[model samples]
Target: MSDTGRDSSVSSPEALRSSPPVPGMFTMVLHTHLPWLAHHGRWPVGEEWLYQSWATSYLPLMRAFNTLAAEGRENLVTLGMTPVVTAQLDDPYCLTGMHHWLANWELRAREATTRTSGEDTGFAAPEAMRAFGIREREDAARALDDFAVGWRHGGSPLLRRLVDAGTIELLGGPLAHPFQPLLNPRLREFALREGLADANARFAHTPGGIWAPECAYAPGMEHDYAAAGVTHFMVDGPSLHGDTALGRPVTDSGVTAFGRDLQVSYRVWSPKSGYPGHAAYRDFHTYDHVTGLKPARVTGRNVPSQEKAPYDAERADHAVDVHVADFVDVVRRRLISESERIGRPAHVVAAFDTELFGHWWHEGPLWLERVLRALPAAGIRVGTLTDAITDGFVGDAVDLPPGSWGSGKDWQVWSGEQVADLVALNAEVVDTALATVDKALDQAASTGSWAPRDTVADQILRETLLTVSSDWPFMVSKDTAAEYARYRAHLHAHATREIAGALASGRREHAQRLADGWNHADGLFGALDARRLPR
Candidate 1:
């Protein structure tokens, strides 16, 4: 580990204030990701996930970024748009379905207002329901209008505008958000390359940074990253074994790994405590079953769902103000201490999932906007990871240990006894898919009749990639919709096997049928060509 030389001379507050300002940099990284959910299922666990997140999180976040950009706030944060999530956002099915979902949300909110007194049996009282309904109705209306104006041509236009305006530094990742540490090396490289290509094709700008799905890594992966043209990526703070206050270049590689600042980041979100748990914020778990909207506040952790108080926007806004100030103080104090300790400026990188704002925590977006504005006014420098590097925050090279952001900061969440079956299944599916595709390509080349690109081969790769998504094992470990996650995983695995079997048996007609059926159901990556797979 490299020593951050400590300077004890500038100890007093007055001296610190009088001295030239240390080049303290603050960068917020938001990882936006979701598995390929389009055309899979619709109601409880499938496409609805896409539409709900799009309306509540993606739309509102874009609006927030645009607002800041309009005020000349450049490089406010780093936004990661995984290729799989981007694909769904730009899919015609998802776009149309989202519009329809928003329209229905408005109707549902309107209906809630007129429900009979006895029918309002949710945690919120009738009057509270009416208030919540009206607010939701207006929100849905605004979102619908925004969608029509900005997202009709898919999210690419809106996202491109953000990048072009310098509002955010976009980060791209693997095509399917596969757990790269466990993936076959050939497929891993292929996914990374294709993912970058997808982002360039959509945004007309290639990202120099990547999110490194789940921050999961094994030794030597840095070589793969450098080869794929990635200059920087993120890993959990503990991956550095506690020396995570600054970005560090991997051993001998130009690529840098920025570690998440757990102290600052966990102030807003953590497994045990965070701003979202405030008494006045809307409770994510409790909901009004009638309208499928959350209508209660988290009165207390021990309080039963039925005993929670009805959510009040006024109270939540007050909480946002309080937490925002507290967060700003935390950042300020951290920078001062670290700068003094390192004898120079320090960089603080706080990262979180993008869905935490607006989707999981209703007041999160408001808190974000307030924090962005407050930090600059308080003399705190805010910038993206690129800006931090330019400001000289890079440290000496270190070999990172094998780990992820999961519990215990190890691979157990992905490869534990609880998910051993999934691990085995993934290994089998990926190996079979690769062998099948290579064989098919070789046979086609020798015959010289048809092109090497086979629909069956394409579908096999698609399903195989889908099977390898990290979400299934995570959901299973967390027990949050584990059944649905398993169903999705197995469904794709079965499809891969069926398609590969048909192709291997020389049953072209049967293989085509399987390809068409799977394509109609799980298609999102229209640009994926199996011929690109390494032979």
Candidate 2:
């Protein structure tokens, strides 16, 4: 049904009772992604990133889902788990490392307690630090227990259980989360296929939708999506020219492109204003150097980190309640207004990064739980993208222009001047790696023997994918751990070059040695097969 020119105003309660309720829906889409961090680095930057997010975000998120599921709630969210992140979560090395990291967190908390009791220690505030440590210790201990019982085998089983139980609609993305718009067409197609295969292998179910890396797209991506069997994807609100109330079919393809309702999304988290900026919430920037804990709240926008107030759980919880109500009201009004404006039912997609829930905003999971429960009571229907589409929430076809959810709502963040060097580097690495692998595959086919696997070719593809991760350019542009991002990108690029060099020289022994070293260093995608690359 197309929109009719009708007044988009809600009538009074009496008048509303006379008229049928507007058919409206809300879909919460969370993109859960992280670069392959295992076997990369340790403290302050690498594996810690994975473990911290796992314990604080993924674990708590599972608990939230389990809580809702026990109450018989289903399809509460559309969850996107990128293949690279899945690789790490399902890796034996990462599983063991995360367990050890959790244990160490508990020990560190105890050590902080001991240090505070004995002497002044020159720490910022001993009492607050001690309290924070004790709380973190308990949290870590509980998370450890959860991991031992539920995640011992890896995250695949847990996630698969949720899918089977209909707790979430899983969305998968390409390997390494490359910026598909800029990537070579062949590599992009290959990555998408392998990523979908990875998800199917792990969860035993294929995702009908994908959360495009960075919510980015150029023209004709719909054709590729259709080829990959993707039924739907997401783009920024402006991509739909600000009319983001419904999912739009791309060009003439069956694939649907859902534009995120930034009005509702930014209300929860934005640079200028959001629930997380509340004074009572834990400050993400300010940290205790000695204990390595965030003890301060966001006292004020411009307040120095050292001057921020200590975090208060009660205060933060109060803020959560307030924001939850505010957000619910926002969604309610937006849905009604949109429905009335279009003279038809409307669908609103509020999408965000899953890590923002717990890792960035400490109280985000609680907020999510409350919002999910409250929306239904307030007469709003909450569902996944699949449910929305199945219920006929699609709009007219749109020829989407190239854009991302980044600053400027375009590709500047990934392909801007600041990261031009890395862009060139990625292009070179991908081109060389693909050419070398293609040549190797030709030689193998000519020999008519597929007996011994070409491990070097496999490693080359792996390195190429890793080198092109969108995280590197993003980090470089943000200047937050930019050096480490560059180093990692260069490391992968160099490995790809050296390995390809060995293959070109026909030095199987040297190539095998180098491949073995890289395989150990970057070993998340164990099931990745180089032979799958299209010649």
Q: How would you encode candidate 1's per-residue C-alpha lDDT over 391-473 as one tens digit per residue?
A: 77988999988999999988888999999999999999999999999998888788876665688888888888899999999
Task: Report model 2's TM-score to 2 decimal places.
Answer: 0.93
What is the Å distance of residue 456 in model 1 from its true position? 2.4
**Model 1 TM-score, all chains together:** 0.93
State the number of backbone clashes in model 2. 0
For candidate 2, the 10 contiguous residues with the lowest summed lDDT are 1-10
Number of the predicted model whose TM-score against the real structure is largest: 1
Q: What is the C-alpha lDDT of each candidate?
A: 0.86, 0.86
Candidate 2 regions with alpha-carbon error over 4 angstroms:
1-22, 112-126, 449-453
Give lDDT: candidate 2, residue 71.
Answer: 92
Q: Where does model 1 exceed 4 Å of error?
A: 1-22, 115-118, 447-452
lDDT of 2 by residue, 1-535 (tens): 0011112352333332244433699999999998888877887789989988887799999989989998999889999999998888888888899899888878877766655555543324677777777777888889889999999888999999999999999999999999999999989998998999999999999999999999999999999999999999999999998899889999999899999998999988887777787778888888666666677878787888867776777777877766776777778788989999998989999999999999998899999998888777667789999998899999889899999998899999999999999999999999999988888888888887662468888899989999999999999998979999999999999999999999888887898899899989868676778888866
